[model samples]
Target: MKVENLYSKSEENPMKALVFDKSGIENLKLKEIENPTLGPHDVLIRVEKSGVNPIDYFVVNYIPVKPMPHIPGAEIAGTVEKVGDHVKGINKGDKVIVYNRIFDGSCDLCLSGREMLCRNGGIMSVITNGGWSEYFAIPDKNVFKIPENMDWDLAASLPVAALTSYHAIKELEVSPNDIVVIFGASGNTGMFAVQLAKKFGAIVIAVSKKNWLKEFGADYVVGYNEVVEKVKEITEGKMANVVINSLGSSVWDKSLEVLGYNGKLALFGTLTGADVKINLSSIYSKHAKIIGTTGGSRRDLIELINLCRDCRVKVWKTYKLEEGAEALRQIMSENRDGRVMLQL
Candidate 1:
């Protein structure tokens, strides 16, 4: 068990990893560890691409799910280098997308075919070793094979952003010709929501800091300050049938403000803050409903990947694995829109 700096590529099977020996990105260091031993139901993946997400930072800095010396990478797409004895339908050289949520296969919820509700399961990188390395092992049940023609980076980007948006869209019950307003529309999940909501036949109003969101198919793009007013104008006083808010606190009130009668407010993130003062009367008066979601189910992820494969969810940006820390920083400092990724 020797710890070494990550300066150059390793020529051995034991790989290099940026490990957080303690909570905080500053504690992250490059170290070498033994190659993973495969379990009967596992597949060894040669990591090709990993998605950078804000939740990764929250987990690394605050969550106690995993002990010190943890690795933080959730979304992944790669080639299968080896499959375990019990693994089937997945094999060497198969391109695949890793489902970042792990469910207890024996749970009643899991058995009911809704494993995303498995009481015992949690996120992939939160405790288990994740994809911020040259290689990692995943349960065969958590892996989905992708077509060879698919781009690895785009496939990696699908697990969280795309799937979560798909789930939120489902939660919002978006219908054809509906008016959908998405807060943080320039964000990773928000951008995906704009695309998916549109494809679902909604006229999407994206609330973003930038106007370029129109490039991604947002029917209308407005800044945070203008969201409520603009939605009113765009819908011609109809407001919105559904409002998607991943941004918390700063925009929560506004999300509620723009909802029409029987509207749905789907919350997926609390970036600004969580707790909010609510007017109970507003809910009853407008007949609006508030719903919340974390990541999405395996079905949502698989469908998202299929969408990516069809050139629906576009690739955003990529950084080398060595610049992993920088990649996280960029997600915090640079454009919050689109999928920011790492290439191994």
Candidate 2:
């Protein structure tokens, strides 16, 4: 296959992208915009596939307008078409996954190998234009090489959902005997969390609406009705050693309620609204730890890619770029079982 170098800008060039004119609106119109100019340390990518995440809609509809007509998307897989002057180790035509978090290497967090938590961290699609386009440019350090044999759609799905799961599972320090509870286990991120927890040797107890449990490979699946009791029963009144909550407030109390003493509750997302009331006694009494996680580092992304490359992990599905919005809609409506991708 002859890889196209779309990022090589001439005097006249244009790129197609989905853009939102304002917040609180669901409409995203396709527009022909100027190709992005690459910086000295940047690598330009011709996106082959972009993964749709829940945050894409949240920021489009909820976030305050930073600029008019924002393009919202984060995860993407593509071929590097151009490399800036200072870029090294990556060449044009390399298959790659773009990490959304951009940080200065000189920052304290970055210096300590915590680039995801750097004070100057910038998230693609949120702070800047993202991968909902034909081509995009990002720092070379943010692009992890994807194995040539790996499916582009799967590669696209890795940047956000999988990375976040990797980060959360790492934080939990899950062991083979630990009982891990995954809230919203059917969603893309949640499903990845479930699989990752299981991979780490934890016995997974996936929690979701009654109808979605079987699909998630949950040992004990429960619905909204008697959720806490069901979980308690599943654990024989012992509860989980680690609770991974990607749905946030919707399952906050239940997550906290189902943790064993000294259990860790890793909160990654707020898919179902953010606000929730929690009892302080429950946390303190059980010595439960509530840890908040965001994105992952370059090293984490590399590890995840290697895992997927080695067949240790599998992606659910792959879609073409034209199907981007539809993929997003299915994910947002909870109609999809696994990660949805947009192929270029």
Tell me, by TM-score, which candidate is best. Answer: 1
Tens-digit lDDT track for model 1 on 1-344? 10111122444567877688777777777777667667778888899988888888877778775634688888888999999899989989999888887787698977876676779877877756667888888778889988888877668778887788898898788999999999988777887888889888999898877677787788888887878888888888989999999888988889889999999999989888989998999999998888988788787777776665554444456788777887887778755456678888
lDDT of 1: 0.80
**C-alpha lDDT of residue 294 in model 1:** 75
For residues 1-344, what per-residue lDDT tens digits would candidate 2 score against the true structure? 00111244553778888877876435776777778777777888888877777877677777753445687777888899998889989999999888888677788999988888878756777767677888888877788898889876567778987889988898778899798888877776776777677667777877766454444445666665576787688778998899888887877878887899999999988877799987899999999898998888888888888765532223456655555566666667545555666666
Residue pairs in clash, model 1: none
Provide the clashing-pair count of each candidate structure.
0, 2
Q: Model 1: which ten-residue window has the lowest total lDDT?
A: 1-10
Show where candidate 1 strays beyond 4 Å. Answer: 1-12, 311-317, 334-337
TM-score of 1: 0.92
Clashing pairs in 2: 48-344, 320-343
If scored against the real structure, what TM-score would every candidate get? Answer: 0.92, 0.88
